[model samples]
Target: MSDNLKVVENATCTFCGCVCDDMNLTVDVDEHRITKAENACILGKAWFREHGIEQRPFALIDGHEATTEAGVEEAAQILARARFPMIYGLSDTTCEAQRVAVGLADMLGGTIDTTTSVCHGPSGIAFQGVGESTASLGELKNRADMIVFWGGNPAEAHPRLFSRYAVTPKGMYIPNGRKDRTIVLVDVRRTASTPAADIFVQVKPRSDFEVLWALRALVKGRKVDPSIERRTGVSLAVLEDLVARMKRCNYGAFLFGMGLTMNRGRHFNSAALLALATDLNQFTHWVAKPVRGHGNVTGADNVVSWQTGFPFGVNFSRGYPRFNPGEFTTVDVLARGDADAALIIASDPASNFPKPAIEHLKRIPVIVLDPKATLTSRLARVAFTTATYGINVTGTVYRMDDVALTLRPAFPSPYPSDEQVLTAIRDRVRVLLGGNRLPAGAAPIAPAVAAAS
Candidate 1:
């Protein structure tokens, strides 16, 4: 390795929600690529390697190449002129950027939502309904004798979850690591993580809430109907045995994912899981955590909560923060044709969102800020390819367990950070709005003055 090459130690990998912060990355400054990444999983390696790629133009305005300033100006004009606008996709960016997005939405008196609305929004709702008993990953690794993975497959999605957190890692209380812990996996079918499970409970599809409710009944000493086995696909004897061990375990942890949040029951399923964890606390120490998807979606939720007083699906059109899922959420907002323009950052909703939402994006003026050209960018009237966070920009991100971690960049980036661009646009909008503050601590926008006009 040449002296010109820079090595970043203890660098964080912002690929999955795991947020593994033990990577040692070697970046070739001249080539602007990561040459080597030690202690990184496949996903983390890919995330770092892709940071050096800049195949797309720096910025684009209606399919034409433009400077960064021109792109910001156009984005500001679009938001300032719109009656209703939305700012979405903060899951992949830093908390600093997410804060600016919230401020931008307040200024526009528009709606703002994170990708969490699609993934873990139900979990957030459930937490509000029935408060959960939760702990950090370190607690599970150290003190948990029984580790449960429900509706989530950590093997494929979070590659290092087991090795770094629960099953394989050695800790103070679990000195023998895997030998000291009993891993349980509950899903509709066997997954890659099933092979490592000491117990596998296969339930019927969309029956997770039922199974959880049954377990809660069992924990509460209520006699559950024997027919629950037929409905859930898990035998009665299996349920009884599982509940017995759960009560006997020194410390148990239930880690659930989208299976519980996205299915028919939605927030009710998550509520049942959390309720079960709380119920088990009477017999033994227990905790539950939602398996977050993206690297910084948890951070997005946190920043939005602290800044806007809500998690996701927040609306400011009333000049005050109001949250109502399924109504104020991104998908519903777009599907209802409530938003005339959108400012999307670090997310590709056009490809990932439902068909109706994508159709709406096609008709509206869309602004996208991302490092890569995504399907959403193709439809964007103004798209600016920005730097990848955690690799090229330094900021704070929250782990799935709500642990805050500061991210350091391994290499400098040519593109401006999302915070810089959003701040510039906000400043420009401030000027365009005649420099008066709005009701929601936002700069006033001169009505009827169109940016594209």
Candidate 2:
């Protein structure tokens, strides 16, 4: 350790989608490691402290250690030779790397999707169906007087959400902060976040759609069956009171999470909640936002939406972008054995995906690019041990509330960044597939690169 350490202020922490940007990092220049991270959450501190351990080969091909160039070239050859290829996992990387991935899909005439396809894909589908009424965290901090947490355990997942933005933050309109806010938690069971709520509504599991639909009907001044209480485990009186209070609030916000999106009804559950939020806006200022899970999943959605004209589950097989969630999503594509080759970056589907999908993924030629070794890397044909995003490379990432913040690197990285590796692969694949030019009718990648910059 050096006596003189490097100090980096205002470095963004990319652990979760919160993107907390006030961290002060102390870096050991000689060791190229983060010694301390001030003003960081537990997750951020753990993520920062674990950087700069690059003991294995920076790149591997067919389980053999290889140079980065040879690995990229082998990966390019595999992707260029494949008839059906799919690229996945941009939630943990920067928009620059994500753009390169989209371009690679275009050049290979394949498909490109993100990690959001597994977690919040249904929310994106519902957003397209009913449109989202969302506001940035700053707006929530300043004006929201009533906050609802539906099926989200922010206390455990997003520890700083309450203190930094939602419930406890002191803003111009919220002079008393938590005292002036009415916090409600709606989940199938009690969670760590329940203690922070002024009121907790525990509904029956697998009945969120029914409850949300009944609430929407109640909000719209329509009569609902009294048996909803028995079906959803929420009394009629409580539902009536909740709806009445929602209408009375000056500003209300509903922050839902995977509880709604990952359930039986999936997209319909999210659509019902979003429609309820929109209906409430008729009487008061109300909005709804999905509680995204990963660090840059929101940014991945933004980049994919603006670049490919769709959110997740986008396909470029016909030399143009086409989207269909269940059909083109990564899990479904692998489960159906549609993708002959897979390029996974910063995600480990092998560990989390269904057995069928994992089986099919194992059968394919998989290329993995990640900072840490994971289960997916063990089965990959080519693996690139890349640098962690915020610790070793700078990029723009959108917070959970869709607020974009520029990340600053705290120290030097021993390995290449995702952008550098993906760009090198994209160029190599393009040359191997055909000329350096993109196929006809393919969307230009320069615009996406420009937007990311």
lDDT per model vs. reference: 0.91, 0.89
Please list the Cα RMSD from the true structure of every candidate, rounded to 1 decimal place. Answer: 5.7, 4.0
Alpha carbon lDDT at 177, candidate 2: 96
Kindly list the per-residue Cα lDDT of model 1 for residues 1-453, writing each as its tens digit.
345798899999999999999999998887888888898888888888878857778789999999999999999899999888889999999999999899888877888999999999999999999999999999988888999999999998898999999889988899999999988999998888899899999999999988999899889999999899889898878989999999999999999989899899999999999999999999989999999999999999999999888999998876778899988899999988888999999999988898999999999999999999999999999999888899999999999999999997988788999988998998999888866236554535555567787
TM-scores, one per candidate: 0.95, 0.95
The parts of candidate 2 lying over 4 Å away from their true place are 436-453
* Model 2 per-residue lDDT tens digits across residues 310-338: 98888887668889988889999999999
Q: Assess the local accuracy of residue 49 in candidate 2 as a C-alpha lDDT between 0 and 100.
A: 86
Q: Which portions of model 1 miss their true places by more than 4 Å?
A: 1-3, 435-437, 440-453
**Whole-model lDDT for model 1 versus the true structure?**
0.91
Q: Weakest 10 consecutive residues, lDDT, candidate 1?
A: 436-445
